[model samples]
Target: MILLLLTVVPVAAFTPWARNDSAAYVFRDHVTGVLEKRRRKLDALRRKGGDAIIRDAVGRGLHWNALGVAFPRDARDDAFEKFAQTVVAHQPVDRAMLRHDTLAGRRLTAADHDAMRSERRRLATVDADQIGATGDDARNSRRRLAAHDAGRLDATGAAIIDDWGLSFENVTRISLKAHAALGREARKQNLTAGVVEATLLPGDVAAWLASPRLRAALDAYLGAKAYVRTRIGALRLTNRLTAPYSGAEPNLLGYPSGFWHHDRCGRRVKAFLFLHDVKADGRPTLIAEASHRTHYYEYKDLLQSRFSDEYISSNYDVVQLVGPRGGGFLFDTNTIHKGRSDGKRGRTVIIADFMDTRKLYTFKKLRYRGPCGQHRTVKMGGEDIACQSWCRR
Candidate 1:
């Protein structure tokens, strides 16, 4: 069972401007473009080995250190050279083609085409580096790509290019490593074999939090600060409780915030609590089985069959916790879980999201790259999707 702590922070509680406005649109557009480019390249390679041609041509003339030589003192140029090398190692032929010239006329064998496609698929699905690339790099990349595409190559453009160069380098490294991590986790979990959906409820949380008598545990755990109430559409806790120290926010998925996909790296709500009792007949939450992996589209049919809506609707899963006032349930976030609304008493529970901050920082240090874009800041149904995205399986 996956535990997700829903922090029902009223929209009005936080500063109005604290919400990110530019992120969703920009990210949507950028990611779309990146995917498109990858698709086109793969298509070209499949059709005429044109991708190979381009890579060969680019590899031949690009000069291993040309970017560095062109901008000798530019740290960005140096970073780009390093990045290019790394990219080459994974897709040596592509890197070679990108630098080579005479390879333009070279013909690829069927095996070669298959290999290229495999590499393309690998790159397309790779997760962003959790640590590589800084926020600045992402910003710079966006700035440069915008300027270059707009035909503006002034000093500002140069700076943007530098930033973009660094960003590309960072994202490439981070994404590659993250992909590797995902593969390892998948194998460890035997996910390749498949998993079945598990039913979890707020009563579970309450049972865990309750004592031998199964009464409210608020007085024991939360003391006097704990107060239960129904507001908006769900039950919630209003007081603050002490939490273990997690490191500076996680930057999983190469985004500034650590909330783009589960398994990327960061502290996430591992368990959820249901405040009300199950016999109360509350709304049911929906959890998608086998939805934890990146292949979200694969689960579309399953979601449509199960829910009134399709497309997984939003990245965030609404969960209902039903239990006694002080009882709660706990579970991991790695599982696909959601709360459903049967229009009954919205289950109420004290929610707690936890992450191993130390592990998060360690992952960051292992994969840290320069920044390239702003952290994700999109909201859906008054909840932060960025964090949910990170928790996405």
Candidate 2:
């Protein structure tokens, strides 16, 4: 572990400035901090039967934390899960609803929400519904079906709608709840990222998950109810470069977050809500408009490293999601995007991901489910999410 830590932590210095650093001392400090954080996480993941889950995860080269192993879930989670499964959409949303919702009193926006237009597929088309990536499962989505989902954009209903200008009585309350709950995570570890779920979510945020807007959008987009796929969504924090390395990287020690890449999450739309003001320097996410529809799951060979920003910009309209606190956008992460978080500043962003419950739930029952130490495991990005149809290993 020490050798591995030494190799990765110091190498980051060559990439970009993360907070401040005096290579003479900060390197060792970063090593200590990172190891300590991993030890803490390992302790938590190894608790109860969590080790079994960890073994299952590591054996498959997966991230153990996202399994949500051993994390306590109460009655509220059960209720929310049920709500997610039952809610029906009055009307289906369009291919890409680029609108912002309210969070922390801020509104998010996707400049051209309708830009993700495709004649062959709808925003909700699952991987199985279309051609799949290579070396995937046997099907690999070889059969291409023309989504056949024709719709007149429903002003009220959208496949990907966020809570930007739309304010409910609980928006502020939910924001505060998220801060209080997620802030502790940030302060405790100067966290880089975490998958928020279950008890980690405050009451208001959990209730908001069941809100008409989220539910309707999810239901319409999926053409069925959404389900909780272990990771409820992202409850990630990015600390300013003041620390040794930008922040605690407990999730994926060196997950490439800066490059413009697709989330590899297929046929999915995630709602992002910024906890504080996010700007170009604060690691705000920069997205390529219309790429969501244009790229359409061709994520295997995507990223700014290979496909330069200049090239992508030439083909697609790049939209930087810079907004104040509470500002965020519900984007089809399948599009090209990047978060610029080199520690110039830091911010906390929570993402609410609504996955297709119909296919997800149908496959697995209570068979392999359990607390952390003994939870079910899948490859990273989850093989179950839209059939693991995206481009990462």
Candidate 3:
């Protein structure tokens, strides 16, 4: 009976879930939500800190805790084989589009060539410690951060990131010239530049990624040594120009609001630099305070349905992140949050993610063109020797 339950469970659960890829996403997210709750509960009981407790519970050799939970090895293997077989049986061959072809009319420009060249030079000669603080400086920053975290001072990097898993740094502003340039570029590429995972033009990347202010803040946030293991991913923009959008969609919180979702299953931090002044009407990102540490039921419900006023009142200490142009926030992606526009005009932000080798969920190979037009590649997530070389360099 035990063996039968193990054999039948995965089939019963995942079969329907797999039929609709959309449903599969929902199911997977729901499972991770439950797991996150369980892990936190277990952590409290064990009195462990800093991912140590959950790591112990989930680690089986090098594999994570999710690998073999609902299925026995043989059963899971059989299920995957059957799924692959069914896919192969149904999939059709189409040779008209070559895999190596770039997107139509997306040819690289002179600025792209320049940016590529600059990026390669930076990567090849970049020193981690060049951006890192000395030991004494880090210690001093930590002391100041601790005070700020305790509310003895204004909110700073230490207070938000160390305790709240968020940072609203009142850092240096993005210059008016740079902001206008970004806006102009957005207008030129209105069709593609502002969406999620949109490949940034070389000029945009060169401007934002090369910001000395951003680098300095990141250095302070990651500490001296921790900053060394970091890699930048997805330096894209969030453009919400078509405002007065509704967040009333039934399927996947269909609306122009920030839906509650974690960025990844594992630990990751993302940053958003507002290129212009952001107000409530601009559809600023709403974060549930400390939702990273505590599981809120409203988050679960909101995922399946629409956001309720009652739900917001009862469940969340919602933090509407409103700030001026050049100001920004950095936050742990594990927190449940949403962003939506409500005004007539759209708001634009420079969005970027900083991934540490320490925590990850999905893995993707990152490729870049070198200064000499040579191909360079590194994996974004998961453990890889090549990533170590790349990050360290």
Candidate 4:
């Protein structure tokens, strides 16, 4: 018994699980502090203006981050123009609808109340239904349908994504009760502590899985009604208290939290729902618009180099996604993006990934009924989401 104990102890210590846990424990605090310090340094650099870090980074011609070297102005305008043209004939939104303030000590007019309610309803509707040009009222609905069937991002959806790798629109309004409950439950699971994968509680999962707005967004992006194959891949909650650092990461060792990277393997679509308001100082995510279409791995060697400013500024239109509660963005994970953290107030968001069941990461042969009432089969090594079917995967 004494000999067996001695042998097992040394062998087990070197097992993958034991080694990984030991590394995490030993490095979590040290790496986190190192990353936080880097973030503070970069934040200082950003404050120095155009001629400072940005100019220096762009001056170095080795890195490209934005849409293409020459982002055709007309192409960018055309994407947004289609959506605006569709809404051109509608009655103008009341001026009151544009006021982004809370109802505090202000006097309330009936028009003000009506406008507020109208805006709320408008925010809740999906694009197809919101626009008369594509909805039942449109004479062009049939034409739109045919165009959508061509297997690409729908006209309006394409416009947004073509201009940027992601798009933002308010799709759902969770009740205060539900939103609070979600936070409470997430806190109970201590999801904020580390980058561990987790699933939402059963109650939260059902609400998200059955979200009509999410379904609509998927259909719009797919240009066809898609069947959600998985039980909704893990609903991750990230509290960006310790945002990933942006620095010279030679490898994972000096890599800051959430370093600039894209999800590999396929074109994965994810919905990020912010449970509360995310202001500029609140550690909003920074995404390089339309970076998904470029070859991301080309900059691997430069990733660890000292051109941190270039990685952020060169051709990349970095968008700091700041918005009100219930507002969020749907994006292709293949895009270059990262969460920002100042260690100030953290934000809570639920992210759900959607993809065709056939491309889901699983080894076993599996069959299941999708949310869209279609049966899907997962064979090993199936076709993945290509650019043509940006929304389907």
Candidate 5:
């Protein structure tokens, strides 16, 4: 009886989504068939003696399929046998003719029989309904998943819609959430310490740099080594700008000449010039402060001091600029900044940087002097002269 209760109750509960699906239905049917066959065997045992019944039941249960198949065979043989044994052993029956007598008592009451029949019928109905519903759901899910895989939905859009369908509220909520997440990541990358840096709206400065005349000028200045290209819908020029002299290979460090730097003497030196006007006012040239002093020998000490890998030392002051679209300059390797052409319309400018190759001439007897000329000397055939013109005190 207990074994029957376990088998019937679970099968009834599984009639909905579980039995409706193809895989689940196959498993369910196989298990149910096996249980019914066992039930008949148990009933026959009850007609015989109790000891005979136990022996017969155990023999039948032990001969279960051993191929270890899933669903029908595995589920029934393994699960049902153990369950039946536990139930049969607990029955209050003596060894003599108990099986036959108990079998008579085991017949279900009218209400119980009717209830079981009704439950079985209800399960069949639910399983049929679920089969149709699940098929439709799977088809729709596949279509949507394919569309997403084909790039019809971008990374941000796909993530949002996949979890929540095409609802306006969901889209908007997801977009805002994505923007917030990106902003957080940017802050980490930028190592921003204070207030958030404002980002210009998309296409805000497009008109300013999109003119044919400006493009022509930039092309002429930049030459064939580089050109402008639209990437991710943004108009940007790619070129190797000259960089400060690091006593290394020329192309290895492309320095931006349109920059400024504070020399060891704290004197502001203009490093390069830009050919284009950035629309944004006070748009600064970006600079990363090396934790070490400019001298190469101090680099190891700087690294030891826990200086940030990339530190922002200074930037151009754009506060005085009239508007977002305006010509601006960046100091040399000392300070870092980039041109912003998105601030206004019809604003155009050129960009260029100076390459420092003084290291190549360092061994030519031209003594290295301080920032200002103090003591001067001529080389080779030239006469000795005061270095006042080169070195500063």
Candidate 6:
């Protein structure tokens, strides 16, 4: 059987926050004209401490635990072969659309597949250290990160890459375009920006995954040629109606993403591009530095569960993901982190996910995928759906 780590549970089994999402969402923006009461409720959560906020989340449901060990090979050999064979037979890696193209729509050549095959073995050898964790002692991930950022060139120079080809002006232009596209998508869905994050299709995004700087960074991080997830997106976090809109659901308890959690996906790295200046004041992402190697608590229903802030903060040194408008960074999501959603000045960013080539056949299948604004019939829960993906349910 396929090791369906993130898919075995029913949707209703998800936390109450995930269940209460309405398709037509009224967002809490800085705008004074709309949704006053709703905005105040979200503001209150923003003012609260992490520990208190997390308690509200678990207050409504059971905290599930994992049945298996940490980071086990999610794809058994037989299942991987079967799925790979079916994919090769039906879709086939090619020079055109679907699985053959990059998230930004770059067509893959025979050379690309050949290169990937050569490095396929790297996928199986991944450990916490390969993706982002450093050093032997799990307790020292933060100290190690601090030392490197403070001037350990040997460590910082290896995995962190910043030589992306796009200039700040070019990126700013792209960010503007991305927000406009997301706005159109949100209006179509009757949802606003902060809560709904939509994937960028071929035309909307540029083909930068293959850029040498980024490609080399991912190769160093994954120890293999990286495979892109089909659902890469431009993320926006603004309280103003003008900041790009994407809704995940507001947990009456708390924003699920703001709580501490490690992504259960195996070995993968994500590239985050800042579209505007974000300092400590901007609602920047907070990560327990190098916490990927540490396993504080395991959950049975790991898919929809989160770790307590009290436990994570007590153990790890947390830091903000801050940078200029065109700056970017590569990170392993398995590290303990929270994507901050509360801020005064809105934030705009582009996020891309990549994994080792060998991991491509592993993740549980996405039963539905459609263009951002188009009407696509999803065979989920025996009903038609607007959108669905590995992240967007």
lDDT of 2: 0.37
Error of 1 at 233 (Å): 17
Which is the better candidate, 3 or 6, if ranked by lDDT?
Answer: 6
Q: Which wins on lDDT, candidate 1 or candidate 4?
A: 4
Span of ten consecutive residues with least summed lDDT in model 4: 94-103
Cα lDDT of model 1 by residue, 116-179, tens digit: 3443333223212433545455334333343342232111110111111223443344334334
Off by over 4 Å in 3: 1-198, 201-249, 253-257, 295-309, 361-393
Best by lDDT: 6
Model 1's alpha-carbon lDDT is 0.28
TM-scores for every candidate against the unseen true structure: 0.27, 0.42, 0.42, 0.43, 0.17, 0.51
Residue 35's C-alpha lDDT in candidate 5? 42
Best by TM-score: 6
* Cα-based lDDT at residue 317, candidate 5: 24
> Cα RMSD to native, each candidate?
27.5, 20.1, 15.5, 22.2, 36.5, 17.2
TM-score winner, 5 or 6: 6
> Candidate 6 on 94-157: residue-level lDDT in tens?
1111222211122346775576444332322222334353333322432233234323111221
- Candidate 5 error regions (>4 Å): 1-276, 280-284, 288-293, 296-327, 336-358, 363-393
Which 10 consecutive residues of model 2 have the lowest summed lDDT? Answer: 94-103
* Residue 219 CA displacement from its true place in model 2, Å: 2.9
lDDT of 6: 0.44
